[model samples]
Target: MKPGRNMRLAGLMRKEYLQVLRDPSSIAIAFVLPVVLLLIFGYGVSLDATNIRIALVIEQPDNIARNFAGSFDQSPYFAPRSFSSIQEAETALRRAEVDGIVWLRSDFGSGYLQNTSPPIGLIVNGVDANTARLVEGYVQGIWFTWLEQQMELAGKKMTSPVQLEQRIWYNPAVRSTDFLIPGILAVIMTLIGALLTALVIAREWERGTMEALLVTRISAPEILLGKLIPYFFLGMGGLGLSLVMAQFLFHVPMRGSLWLLLASSALFLWVALGMGFFISTVFRSQFVAALVAMVSTFLPAFILSGFIFDIRSMPVIIQGLTYLIAARYYVTILQTLFLVGDVWSVVWPNAATLALMGFFFHGVVYHKTKKNLQ
Candidate 1:
């Protein structure tokens, strides 16, 4: 009896595998989609601010003003276009030709030299608040450095009372690509794992195959296992491909144990797949299942998972809500493993959450399938 049941389960798995291969959409979702998304996230999205265009308006030309303006030209961060008057600079800014404008008034030389805080105007386009903030910070840094140099040239003792030495951990270079790629991996896995299985049971229902399968000798548990096994491998394959792209193409470091990363990824994939299966079981239409899977999985993974935005900076309620997002745990694990190595303090808790979620989602799927079968 046991051998017959095992054989039946194997046959069901084989049937699912064949069905996956025959479906062009499933093949595209399992394989092609990961690469396209990796390329898009790797190349198209960037957090590093560089080559910012700013108009420099000099009301009066002098040695002091020229020296100050020269510093902006030297910095790689800014592309300074000199304007004769504030009006010209304002025109450039209004036309969106520059991100910011630095204006040095006619009294800048005398007032600045006398420590009167010269009327230096920094007008920044605030369309993108984050970019505006970064530009403002960079400009202030340039101004301070120039001030320090001017003081030293005058033979005055220029020193800060307290010096700050900043050291960043995990990602020492502070490259956004290194930070982004790992989160992209989590998002990609979520899309592939959830979206694929989201269509499975729904497709079975649409084709009138669910009733036929129910009347067969195979039990609901065996059928679910059969569906789960094939797609589980498919999800893992997507993960492997995404990891290779992250390491080779994007040059993201993998400081953790490769085996451990794979293990945690497997746990996360289980949760994602189980969530997809639950959606599939609940919604009979393929279109509805796909939409719900995307809305529930992809959006939460991208937004609440701390992929691009810091959950800590969000409102208290939104921060509290992140605890419910499954991708939050997976993103933490991926970032830690890829950037910080296997810090089990971080990895253990997140992995445990993923395990619990997997069990919960799969248990719900099992209960629903049994009910539907009856």
Candidate 2:
């Protein structure tokens, strides 16, 4: 730990950088991975549960039963299939073909609408808490809202008339796919790729491969970049998976330009990859690297990235910190791209922020890595 040891370490570190640059796997991951991740993230990771399968069982084909079933069909969330009896609907629900089942008894037409106990019952699978809540909320909002409006339309003079005209702005259809696809991209990509990089790199260090390369003739930046290349591609692969799921599987519309989406992703991944690499350099142990990456990237990307919650609603200091998080800008550009379309005015600012932040992290990583690797 004296001057001689420090100088000798610095000399060896320069050589390690060169060997890493020559590694092909690293280069492909760095250059091409970002675009793939944007695609996956844009399409794969969606919050909105679409076409949730529902079986509607009605004993009698009354106007009211038909009307009630009609309302559910009009909703994007429910793909309502009619059945003659409750047993049929229950079978579908149990067999996992349907997420929920609605049963309408023979007397649903007259008795149910007259403030009597509902002849219709909604039975849902409670295994996935999030999907279950979404199904329940959709049924409540869509079916009950229609019922409330019907009562008012009948000209009944009732006290405390509730006039709930709920309008969803930005995403007019209230589609979860629009919001969730972009948000989950920030989360899943980070988890599957960015978070993985630090551990993988730290493992190399712990196992002495990094030291073997250190005796060669590469520069510090080359070594850092080399480490980043493979992980960067891995992250993009995750992104590609998500995009296929979002656009093809879920059928969410692509309103924005794909070019813009790729552009934003490039900048965001740069920052994320840099952050992960820097973490690996700092924490040589795989365990600590994993923990730091999870705490630093995964949790924030999921929660504070505006994936699950609104950043504006958070405390002022927290909101300020979100600016430093790569996921924040990624969320912004991706959301605007997905929901608002190719809005350059809306997208550019976030893109610029990501570029700037990426550079900042790049500088931090270069400095830390050069010292640590040396």
Best by TM-score, which number? 1
| lDDT (CA) per prediction | 0.91, 0.73
Candidate 2: misplaced stretches above 4 Å? 1-170, 371-374
Candidate 1's TM-score reads 0.94
**Candidate 2: tens digits of C-alpha lDDT, residues 1-374:** 56754554555444344544665544444334444545565556566788999888888888878887889888877888988888878888888999998887788887866768665688999989889998888888887667766778887644456765677767887766667767776766666556666766887899998777666655566566555655555566656666777787656667888877776776677778777777887888988998999899888887888886888889999999887778887887788888778888878788888778778777887767553345
Clashes of 2: 23
Give lDDT tens digits, candidate 1, residues 1-374: 49989999999999999999999999898889889988998998889888899999888888899999999989988989999988988999999999999999999988887889887899999999999999999999999889888888898866779876788998998889999999988888898788888887789989989888888889989988889999999999989899989988999999999999999999999999999999998897999999999889999999999999999899999999899889999999999999999899999999999999999999998878862454
- TM accuracy, model 2: 0.61
How many residue pairs clash in all the candidates, one count each?
0, 23
Which consecutive 10 residues in model 1 have the weakest lDDT in total? 365-374
TM-scores of the candidates are: 0.94, 0.61
Best by lDDT: 1
